[model samples]
Target: MSAPLSRPSYAAVLRVPRARSTFAAALVGRLAYGVVSLSLLLATVRATGSYAVAGTVMALFGASTVLLLPLRASLVDRYGPRRALAPMAVLYAALLSVLAAVTWRPGTPAVVLGAVTALTGACAPPLGPTMRMVWGELVHDRRLLQRAYSLDGVAEELLYVSGPVFVGVLIRFASPSAGLLLSAALIAAGTCAFVASPVVGGLRGSSGRRQQGKSPARQRGLLQPVLVAAGAGLTLSAVDLLVTAFAERHGYGGDTVAWMLAALSAGSAVGGLLNGAIDWRTPARVRLPWQAAGLGLTVCAAGLAPGPWTLTAALACAGAFVAPALTTAYLIADETAAPGARTRAGAWINTAVNAGSSCGAVTAGLLLSHASLGVCFAAAGGAALVSAAGAVVGARGTAVAAVEAEPVPEAALEAESGRSGA
Candidate 1:
């Protein structure tokens, strides 16, 4: 009989110098995103008295960010982190301030607000992907990198779960603007600190790391996994919207929405930790499709839940599969991309996620007007299944790419550090 593979330790991944500080700094900025979006949506609605208008405004922000993510990633790759992120962070914070001012003004046109929001989102740095790139730079071992990605997923889930509650409290006790203001402050502070941190590792190296060709998006076999990730994002956003719809349909309090969302995120965090600890011998290509399918099936079951508690439980179950699927997607993306294009690859995943979420929000809104809640849940399931199909179809290409891609050594990385503009 074959011996079992041992799992990687989270501690091993974090043992590198400056890892904790860099991770925490990036996390602050990421947490701000969770606060800003929903808070902005809610504030806009409160001011405009139109859910449609608010949603449109928020969607524009998400859309612009999705469209600009690759460009931003490319910039980061070419110019390095300090040059790319520092100015962008300042501008992003300034724009958020502008947004908050405009939102507070009564009778402000939604169109004008949306335009500003779009521009604001465009200015925001690709912090999440950039942080992952930092991880790839810092963690030399492939298994350690995998664990880092899992930890990233868990941190993101925690942020999404807690950020809303934080914003909710501020909105209830103080004002909706408070959340926006706080988010802006966090981004401004976090981005500057994160970009300037010595712990971010290095991006400039001449160890044959630089590629002289088209970006990863244009590369073969990259598009399908990106699309699959979009499907996963869509399902997640759909579930979020459905929870809101379910709360409103049943006349549940606003806090109920927070609890439901928290339940989902909590489950994801748990799953991520568990996933990171496991030593999976199977390739991501083999695991992703099954994980996505399972996520869909679980979410589909949520529609039939009889009560808030039941729905929360079902959503939690669905969330358990999310991090594993996302981890697989990231792995596949890294494998399929060119050496120099890893940052761009990570950005593509981020773009796909935002795009899918925006699309899901729109779809859920339409379904709520026409179909039953249960039906809407099934639609989310359908989207997840579609993602599964995409993953299955593209798995072979990524697997082949993985076999060909070589891991850069830690010594080579450090040697190249001095050459980085950052």
Candidate 2:
């Protein structure tokens, strides 16, 4: 039984130089993405003078991400992150520059902008998933994986919180194009640095398989925990929308909404740091419940906040659970995925979150347009409760046992990995 795969100590994992680099790369890449996202929204609005059209362009970008992400995951799985990172980063940078240039010209057709945006979207670097996969492969111990995930989650929150603010400030004081251009440069530099890092380049896939004279084709599957995590992601999306609407309704203007959102991200950053600081001896079962409770509390606080400041505090508290939940999900997914299918599983999680976000956004918009803000808050709180319930349920099952029974084929794993690494 491989000694039940005892969890590795936290200190042992932190000592890994590669893990540190991976985390740094993830942080920078995410920050760059945040800047680009805000810049794109502003640029589109500036160019078209139509919020509706700007929204459409952004939606297309999301659609492109949803469609192409899986393919990107496949490439990561097959070729490793090092091999595929550069092209994607370069292409993303190039596309962003093109977007800035075309938007600079007066009378640049919206159709042309939309087409470029979609094509550029395809170039998005699969940094998050690839990093997660690499962490899983390189870290080995389950406890280490949890810590890594916790840190990654925190970085994600920080990026979303700070990146947009930076972009917004730059656009207001400098030029909107500056934000976009900076985003490109950051992505290019970060991606290249990650690829060239000794830890990433020196690592080889399937050391165990090679020693045993087995081929890489021997690994692939459905990873049940990831699927459950994906479901939970849907719930989180719904909650996010509810919170946003609730803030807007309570006399919090657009700026307040941004701050409230940032509060949540900040909380996530805290959670991630906490995860990394904790001892690995703690069982996930115990840790997961506490995380869920935090999430529930966040919702309740957000729903009941009497003023904008109070609501922001509540949102931050709620946000603190974000990394823990993500850590739980990523750990589960890593355990359940077939060796080569890790990236796909991660990408699927991303897809689920995006889908959930889309649904939540639409629902929240409709509700806010027609109903009171309190109702939106209540709805969001309710959705968060659902997520908490799901996490509770997930905690009870073994990572491998929580997933579907069907096994993924080795060929499929290879194919998907290859596509992701590309």
Candidate 3:
């Protein structure tokens, strides 16, 4: 007989039948998102010769994407991913190709760039939210879901970091437009593989639609997690700008800024994995606020660091809370969603993060001019603390208590999960 498995590990997540292939395909496509934003910005600047134009185009793209997220996710819920996600990916890729060709040479018309970019953002497939929903479908056990989210979040963090580096390398030998073209290709291929996965094939049928029609599927508990998620995004972004200013004030080089950011990412990755490894009896709802508050406290302390090294250490410590917090939010999202509505639930969390990031960048900038660096950091932390407080207050007033995301019972698991086994 084969030796019995002893401990739960991230490896167990991959062992779920069809989950490995589905998740791998999703990641391949998601890497394109990491590459596209920077590549587009650089390509636009090169062609238009104006940072203002490039920045505006990027902002429009972000806003359009965030605004339409829930609607797109709703389409996926109403239709299966194969029906909904495929056309979206195809159109998005085609528009990206148009973007690449237009910006390949200098002097592309600004009007043309803006038009294509807005359309591209609108068509961008809701791959990340879809993937998280897939994880929910694949892993019925609560522990496995935690590991899956943690793993997914950590991998995503790395993808964004590496995406920029990849663009930098590509620009050295080729034009930034080449990176956009590559992103187009990556998304097309990855999305095709993802939709075609056997597990995804199980997500079809009208059961989801019927389930969503029921009153129990209302998803009343979403606000607390969403609020916390927004807070996390806001303060985390402020840390980026804060670190840049912190590095400059200390006479540190640009490399120090990079190192500090990288440290934050590393800490998040480690923390996420560690968080998943534990078997917690506590509900995600209970843990989430404390996680946000812990992050708030650490960021506030980061402001008090006396030296560059200490500040980096402080940021790293704060980042340790990052992935775990986001992971918990997604868990709550999955729990709160109805059978067919997981995509919409996850998309709301994504939207919250982006909205918070937009405000955070501007808020940090404004605070920098009027306040000391320490004050700026404190303000960032305070945002998170307020979010935590709001969650607590909202819970008290609401008729519905935010329920814990408990493991699905075996009978229900078999009915709900996709091509199960790990």
Candidate 1: stretches off by over 4 Å: 1-7, 46-52, 107-111, 172-175, 205-218, 245-256, 368-370, 397-422
User: For model 2, how does the per-residue alpha-carbon lDDT over 1-422 read when each residue is reduced to its tens digit?
Assistant: 01123454455555675666666766677678778888888888777787887888898888897778978877776666777777899999999999988776456778988999999888898888877777776666565667667766666766766787798678777667678888998898888878777766754443234222122221222223333344345445665676566655565667777677777777778867787667656666445556655676567567667787887887787777767766776675565567766776777767766765676667666777776666666665555556556655655444444344347877789888885445
- Give candidate 3 regions above 4 Å deviation: 1-7, 205-208, 211-219, 397-422
How well does model 3 score by local distance difference test?
0.87
Q: After aligning candidate 1 to the native by TM-score, how far in Å is the CA of 266 from where it should be?
A: 1.4
Kindly list the per-residue Cα lDDT of model 3 for residues 5-119, writing each as its tens digit. Answer: 4355788888877878899999999999999999999999999999999999999899888989999998888888998899999999999999999999998788889988998
lDDT tens digits, residue span 100-121, model 1? 8877756888888888999998
Q: Estimate each model's TM-score.
A: 0.85, 0.80, 0.91
Model 3 vs. true fold: TM: 0.91
Could you say which candidate leads in lDDT?
Answer: 3
User: Against the hidden true structure, what lDDT does model 2 obtain?
Assistant: 0.69
Candidate that would win on TM-score: 3
Cα RMSDs of all predictions?
Answer: 8.1, 8.6, 7.0
Higher-scoring candidate on lDDT, 2 or 3: 3
Number of the candidate with higher TM-score, 2 or 3: 3
Best-to-worst ranking by lDDT: 3, 1, 2
